[model samples]
Target chain A: MANKLVAHMRLPQPISNLLAARNIQTAKDALSIPEFDLMTLLGVDIEDVRDALARISKVASPPYQTALSLLEERLINDASSGRLPTFLKGLDAVLGGGIPFGVLTELVGPSGIGKTQFCLKLSLIAALPMSYGGLDGRVVYIDTESKFSSRRMIEMGRNSFPEIFYSEGMAQEMAGRIIVLHLTSLSEITESLQQMKLRFLQHEVKLLIIDSMAAFVSGDNERSGSMSRDHLLNCPFSFLKSIAEFSCIPIVVTNQVRGHNNDGTSQYSFLGKDTDNNSEKFMNQVPALGIQWAHAVTIRLIFEAHSGQKFIKVAKSPISPPLAFPFTVCSSGIALLSDDGIEMLGQEINVIRSQGFFSIFDAS
Target chain B: MEVSALPISPTNKEKLISAGYTNLASLVIVSPIRLSRELQISVQEASNIIKVTLQCSGAVGLDGRHVVLRGAQTAWEMFSDEQNLKHISTGSEDFDGILGGGIHCGEVTEVGGVPGIGKTQLGIQLGVNVQIPIVYGGLGSKAIYIDTEGSFMPERAYQIAEACIMDTLESFRFHRKGAEDCHERMQPNYFLANILYFRICSYTEQIAVINNLNKIVVEQKDVKIVIIDSISFHFRQDFEDMALRTRVLKELSQTLMKLAKKFTLAVVVMNQVTTKRTDGSFQLTLALGDTWSHSCTNRVILHWDGNDRRAYVEKSPSLPQASASFSVTGKGIRNAISHSKRVRMM
Candidate 1:
C-alpha cells in the first residue's frame, strides 16, 4: 500500500529515493518529516520539497476530481454565490443578479461611452456594507490611465445612498476600503499582479477592477520586439483569471474598442434607424487585445453612445442572453433608464421639436 | 582548487576543467549542451553550473550598476571609434548632403511618403550603393533588404546597380590609370549578390527576422545596412488595437536601433502616410501616429511637387528643415536641374 501510494504521488525519482532511504514509507511518513529536514538531508531545493509534499498530500487526501465535479459541488453549496449586485435595478435584473465571482468580466467601449462611469459605480457598490447589497469587502482599483476620480465616487455615493454619505465619517471609511493602484506599464502591472496574492489576503480584497487594461498593455515599449506582445498581454490576464478563481473575487476589467470594419462597410453609425441595427453594430465593435483577449473574459459588457444618450449592452455572457438597456451618466454616476423613462424622454424631445425651442434638460 | 569551490562533485570538477572551463567566465559563456555532453552531466546541472559561474563573476547581477558602468566605457570607446562611425552613401549627392553624409550609421533613419513617390526607388538605390568598395568613397558593406510590402524589385535593383557601377567606373577612370581592367569583377550581379533580400509577409516573420539579424550580421560580416521597405504594411492593416500595435512597433524600432548601434549599421525604415484630421482639417501624417514619431533619429518626407519628386527634411537632429527637388529617372534618383540652371547651361 505504501509503495502503491508512493507510485501514485509521482514524485521525481531522486526525491522518491531520498524519501524511501529516510524510511518515509507512506504519505504520512513523508509529511511527518519536516520540510527543512527534507531539504537539508535530501539536498533538494525548497521548491522540489514543496512539490513532493503537495503531491504526497494529494495522494493521502480524497481522490482528485474533474473541474465539472468541483464546479457542481460549489454550485450546490452556494446557489446564490458569485453574483455581486451592480445596484442598478434594470442592469442587475439583466445581469441575473450582478457580476459573477471566480471569473473575469470585461467592460469595453469607445471613449465617452460611460465604461469608466459604470466601473466607478461598481467600485462604490462593492465597498458598501452587506446590508446595502455590497460584498462588504475591499476593492482593488488598478488604474492604468490615471482617469479614476474620487470626487465622482463621492457624488455617486451621495446620490445612491445619501444617508451613508451624510454620516460624515462613513464616506471616508468607505473610500478608504477601495485600494487604488496606478500602474503605468505592462511590466509594472504584471509585477503588481504577481505580488497581489499577499495584498489580496491582507486587505480582504473582494473586487478587482482594472480601469483600462488596454492602456498599459498597448504602450510603445512593447513594440521592442524582444518578447511576444500577445504573450506579454496573456500573462497578466491569465494571472488575473487565476487570482479571481482562487480568491473567489469578481475581476472587472475595462478595454478600449475600435470601429469594426465588416466587409469594407462602415458598421458604426451615431444615429441609426432601428434599435436592432444599433445593438448589432455595437456588438461588432472589436474589443481591444484581439480575439484571444475576448475569449479570456467570462462576461463582456459593451457601452455605446447614441444621439446624446448612452446604452449598455450585454455583448457576451454565460448566464444571460444578449441584452441592451439605455443608461444615463450624470453627477450621481451611471443609472439605468426605465422603459417608461425612455418613452418620456422621447415625448419630451417631441414636445421640444413641436415647440421649436431648445430648453435646458435635467438628467436627475 | 578554484573548480572545487563550486558545489559540484570532484569527478564533475575534473570533467569541467578537462572540458577547458578553467575559469568562471569560460563556464558562463559556454553552451549548456556542450558542457553537459563534455562533463557527462544533466542539462540542468550544466545550466546550474553556468548560473553559479555567472553569479560569482558578477556578470549577472540584480542591481545592474556594475554591468551598466562596465558597458558604458566600452560603448563610449566604440562611439569614439572613427571606423565605427562610417555612413553608407545613398547614391544621390544632394540626398547625401541633406542626410549629413548619407544614411548614418548607429541610427535609425525613416523615409516617409505616399505610394509611387520614389521611396522604394531610394531604398533600392541605397541597397546597391552600400556595396560600393570603400576605396570608391563607400562603406564597401553588404545590405539586408527586408521587404514587407512586396515592393522590393530585383529588376529595379539591377538597373540601379548598373547605373551605380557605371558612375563608380567613370569616376574611377578619371581618378585612376587602369579602371576598365577590373570592370568584369565589378558587375551588377556582384552587387545584387551582396544584397541579402528577406521577404517578410507578416509582423511575426518581421520580428523573427529582426531578432535573428545579429546571427545573420555575424555570419555575413560585410553587412552594414539594413532596410525595411515599408514598416507599416502588416502593422496598419492587421492591428485592431492601437496600443498593441504601438507596443509591437516600438519593440521593432528598439530592436532595429539596437542592431544599428551594435553592428554600426545604417537602418533605413520606409513608412507610409495616413491622412489624419487635425484642427478640423485633414493633413498627411506618418502612418503609425505620434507615438512612433520619436522612434526614428531622422525622418525625411518624400512627396510630389507637380512633375518633380521633392524630398523634405521633416525632422532631424543635425539637419535643418529643408526641401530638395529630386527626380526619379530611368537611371536613378538625381537632383532636378532648375529651370534657371537649364536655361544657363543651354
Candidate 2:
C-alpha cells in the first residue's frame, strides 16, 4: 500500500532523485521522517519537502489509537501469539509456551551458569527447519566476548535432532543460517546493530542474541567517557529495542550479575531491588545495567547453578509467578529434567527462597 | 594448540605442520631463523607467522591475504582446545585440584582477596611453578610479574624457588630409588632469571606495562604466565573519574584477553577486595564492580575461613564451584595443615 503511493504520486524530478538517493522507496519510509527534518537532512527546498510530505502522508497516516480500541486489538493479537519453546524442564509451560516472540527477553545470570548454552539453544531453535518445530529463519548471534562456538552448535544439532542434523547437508545448512557477529566495544556493537537494520530483510532474520550484553558495557562506556550517563544507560539498549520492534523479531540479550552497593551513587551500582519476593537473591548481587535496564526488558529469566543443580527462574513476567525450573544441559541441548531429577531438586523453591545458598553454606 | 587454530594461511599451516612444527606450543619461544631454515620459507614469512601468533587475540593475516580468526567458534572446539591447554600449576596440588588442574592458558583468571590472604605468595609461587619442565606436566614457560603494589619480593620468590628445587629433586630421587644421577641443574638463580619482573608504581605504568605485553611476549615467545599482582591497586586510589577508570580498565582487560588468546598464555590479575554495604550489612565484593567480573574466564576468591585461609573457585566455565583450604607455609602454597595433617613450618 505504501510502496504504491510513491509511484502514483509521480513527484518532481529533483525530489524523486533525492528520495531515491536516500533509499526512501516507499511512503512508509518517507513518512518515518518528520516534516521539518526532511528538508535539512536531504538538503532540499522547503517546497520540495512540503510536496513530498503531503503525498507520503496520504498513504502512511499517523497511528492514533484509543485506549479501548488498543485493548481490543491487543486481546486479539495476544490470543495465539507465536512462541519459541525452550523444551526444557517444563520451562515452556511457565513461559506461556516458550519465550514469546516480539519482545526483549533478558537472561540475567553470573558468568558461566549456562547463559551461553541457553542462548545457543535458542539460536539453534530459531535456525531449525519449520517442520522440526523451529522458527525456520536465520539468527543474528552477536557475541561480545567471543564466546559463541559453532562447533558446539553442530554437536548440539546432532544431539537434539540426530537424524535431521546428521543427514548430509543439514548441519552445514543450519550452521549457515545462524550469522555470528563477535564485537567487543559499544561503538562497534551499535554500529553492527545499525548495519543489521539493512541485513534483516536480506537475511530473513527471526532472532537476535547478544550472548552477554554486560561483557563490554563498562569498559566501552569508560573508554568513550564523554558519553553522558543518559547516553550510557539508554542509547544502545533503546536502539536494540527499536530494532526488535522494527523488525518484529525476538531479541534475547544476556545480562551479567553485578555486586550491589548500598551507597548506590557509584556509576555501575544502580541495581535496585525490583523482585521484592526474591530480595534474598538480590542481597548479594544484582543484574548489570541497573534499574533503567530492569524496565527496558519486557521479560526476564534468571539462571542459577548451585552445587550441581541448575534452575531457570521467570524473574519478571506478566504470565507467571517467580517460579523456577530445574534443568540441565546435555549433548542434546537443555532438556526437561526427569521425575527423579526433579525429585533430587526436591523442596528447592522452599529451601532456596527461605534459607538461600549462602545461608546453607554458613550453617554448614 | 593445533596449527589450524592459528589465524595463519592454510598453506602455511600445512607447511608448518608438514615441517614437524605441528602444534602452536612448538612455534612459541622458537627463533624465526630456525623456523625459516626448517620450513624453507623466507625469514620474513617465518617472522611474520611468529609475530602474528604472538599478537593479542592477534593481528591476523600478516600475509595480508589471510584474516583474523573469527570469534564464532563452536563450544566443542573450545572444549577440545581447553583439554589440550597446558596449565601452569599454582605450586599446590590441592590448589591445582580446585582450579581444575591449574591456571589454564588462553583465559584470564582473576584472584581477589583481602590485603594479606597470600595473594602475592600465590603470584610468586605461580611465577616459579610455571617454570616447571614440560617433561613433568608443566608449561616450562617464563613469567611476567607486573607488581602494582610493590609487594612482589625477589627474596620471597627466591625462597619459593629454592623450595621448588628441593621438591623436584626429592621427587626425582624418590622416583629413581637407588639411582644417584639427579642432575641438580634446577637452581634458584636459574629460576629467578626466567621471571621477568616489572614494578608498576602508578596506574599509567600499569596500563603501559599491560599494553606492551604483546610486543614483549612476541620477542620473548616462551613468556606464558603474565601475573598482575593486585590489578585493583592503582585503580582503587586517586582519581574521581569512575567513568574514565572504567574505560581504562576495560581497555586493559580487552588487551589481556587478546594476549591470552594469541599467545595461549595465562594472564593472572590479582585484585583487592572492597567492602560494600548492602541490605544493612557489609559484603566483600571484588574491586572494580560487576563489569570487571566478566573480564576473566575464571575468578578465584581468597577468603579467610575461620583461622584458615581458603580459596574458592567462585566463577569458572568448566570447574565446579568449590573451595580448598591452603596455608602460606614457608615452602610457598601448600595444603592447609590442621590437626592430624600438621607439618613443621620453617
Candidate 3:
C-alpha cells in the first residue's frame, strides 16, 4: 500500500474569521486551488497574483475580498489621520498642523537651500513633546551619505538642555531616543526601518526621516533603472505610512535637486529638468514619482538660500497656501531671524542676483 | 452564487469595526459627531452592525487614530518608559549647570563658532569630562572625534585629560611616553589596539568615520561621549553647490540625532564659520545655512572681545536664551561674566 501524506497549515486568525464568516468549511477549502482556479476559469472575477501575495502577507483575513476591504480601510484611515510629518512650521500650519500620516513629506531644493537642515530640524522637532511643536515620539533616520554627527546633536541639545552637554548621562538620554542607521544602498533603508519599528514597539515614533533621499538614487555609480530607484527611495516612506496608519507616525524625506543644464547658471529646478537655460525653461518638478510624489505627499517644503540666509517656502501644502520664512545660520546653529535680518538677507541676495555673480556650483 | 453579499455595503457597524471603533466610549474619542455623521443610516443599523462585529468578530475599538485594545494601558506604559528614560548630568557649575544638569540622551545640540573661536575646544573638553555613570549619569565612556579641519591637537586633549585625571602639570605635558600612556589609558580595559575604542578622523572621510563611529557607540554598553570637531569643514569646502552641501549637512544632522538616541550617548558637534561676501564686503556666517540653524537644539556663538571671552546662548530647547562669557583656562571653562558682575557689585 502506498503511503499517503497530507500537509496542513493552520490559518491566521483573520483568515479563519474570513472563512468562517463566509461559512466555508475551512480556510484551505475556502481558498482551495480548484476554487481559485475555477474563479479565474469562469472569468467572473480576476485574481491578481501579486496583489494576492500582498494580501496574504499583510491581512489576517482568509478571504481575499475581506482582505482587500481591510486594506482599503487601512489606507483611508491613514490618509485621514493626519500623522504624516511636515518638516517646517509653516508647512505644517498650511497642512492643517501636520502632513497626513501614512504618507510622505518631501523637502526639495538645490544645494545650500536648507533642504537637509530642514530635514534635521524636523527630525528633532518631531521627537519633541506636542506643546513645543512636536508629536512627542521617536525617529528612525537613514543616512545614505554617511553624514550624521553626534557632536552636532549634542551641540544642538545643549541649546535646549545645556546641562545635557556637560553631563554624559543627559546626552545619552537624549541620544538614545534617536535611532540612526547608515545604508550604502536604498534597499537597506526600508529593511532597517522595519526592524527598528519592531525593536522599539512602544515608542509612538511620529516620524521616519531620510536625509536627502536623492543620495540613494543618484551618485557616481552607473546605477540604471530610474523607476526602480525611485520606488526603492519611496519604499521607506511607504513603510512609515503603514506604521502611521496603525501607529500614527509621519515620514519626512529630504531631496537634493539636480541641475539639468550645464550652462553656468545658479538657478535650479526642484522637480524636473529644464529644456533651456533660460528661467522660463523650467520644465517640471522631479521627485520620487515624478508628479506622483507631489500628489501623494500632503506637503512639499522648498528651501532656497538668499544671500547668507535660507528662506523656507511652502511650495505645496494640502490645506494651506504657500508662505515663506527667513532663517539664518550662526555659530550656535539655525534660527528664525528677526524680520530686519530677514529683510537684510533678502536685500543682500537681491543685490547678488542682480549683479549676476554666480558662485561655483558644485554638487556634493 | 451571490458573491458573499458584496460585503454588505460596509454598513455602519462594518465601518466602525473596520475603523477599529468598537464601544461608544472609544467612538467618542474619535469625535462623536464624525462617527454619528458617518453612521447616519439608522441607530438600529449602527447598533446591530456593532453587535455583530463585537460579538461575532471580537474586533477591538478605535479612539481616533489609536486602535483601542485591552492591553492598551500596558502598551502605553512601555511606550512612556522608552520615551522618558533620560540620562542625568554632572554638576559642572558652568556648562552642565546651564543645561539643568547634563546632556540629554535623545536631542541634537549645536556648538557653533568661527574657526579660531574654540568650537573644537569645547567639544574636546566634553569628550574628556563625560566619564561618569548614568546615576552620576556618565557612560564612563571615551569619545569618537571627527576632525574635519585637521586641527585636533592631541596636546590640547592631553592637557584636558590630565586635568580630568591626575591634575598634574607633568602629566599634562605632551611627551612621547605621556602621550602613549594617555592613549593606552583612554582605551577601555577590554578593547584591543586595532579596536581603537577612541580616536579622531578627518572631514573627507566623515561618512566612513560616522559609519564606524556608530558601531562603536552601539556595541559599547557603558560608553559615552561622541564628538565631531567642526562638522562644517567638508561641507564648507564642498561649497560649490549650496543645495548639495545642505543635503550633506542635513544627513549629518539626522544621523547624529539617531546615534544619540540609539546609544544614549552624549553627542557633541563643533561648527565652523563661513565668510559671506555681501556688497563686496565679507560678513562671517555659519556654514550650511539654515540647515544647521534649524537642526540644532542649542546654539552657542563664541567670539573674542579684546582680552575677555564671550559665548552666547543663541538657541536652547529647555533653557533660557542668554549670552554668557566664559574663559577657557588651565582649570577648564570658567564663567568670566559672573565673576565680573560680582566684582562690579562689590
Residue-level lDDT of model 1, residues A1-364, one tens digit each, is: 1223564567899888887787677654554345566689788899998678656654443222222233345557542255788877776775657897767888877776678888888888888998888877788899988899999888989998898989979999999998899988878877887777886655388789998988855544322321255445756765676677667788899988654433212111111223334334434454555444654566777776544555676655533433556677778888778631221111011010101011214332
Q: Using Cα atoms with residue i matched to residue i, what is each candidate's TM-score against the true structure?
A: 0.40, 0.40, 0.38
Clashes of each: 10, 11, 81
Residues A1-364 of candidate 2: C-alpha lDDT, one tens digit per residue? 3344465567877788888888777764564444556788789888888667655543343222222233244447642256786766367766667776656889887676678988998999988888888888899898988899888888888888898787998888888998899787778888888877877655388889987887765444331231243236556765676676566678899988765443432211222333223334435455666444554566778776654456676655544434566666778777656422231111122222211434434655
Candidate 3 C-alpha lDDT tens digits along B84-191: 645433223455556645555556666765333445557656656565322222344545555543334343454555555443224445544434434445432211
Highest-scoring model, lDDT: 2
Per-residue CA lDDT of model 3 for A156-197, tens digit only, reads 666754544457564565566677878876567666766666
Query: Against the native chain B, what TM-score does each candidate's chain B reach?
Result: 0.75, 0.76, 0.65
Worst 10 residues of 1 chain A by lDDT: A347-356
TM-score of chain A of 3: 0.60
Give interface RMSD, per candidate. 25.4, 27.2, 24.8
The digit string of per-residue lDDT tens for model 2 on B10-126 reads 888889888888776778778999988988889999998998777733345434434346665556666788789998878778889999888999989999875445778899899
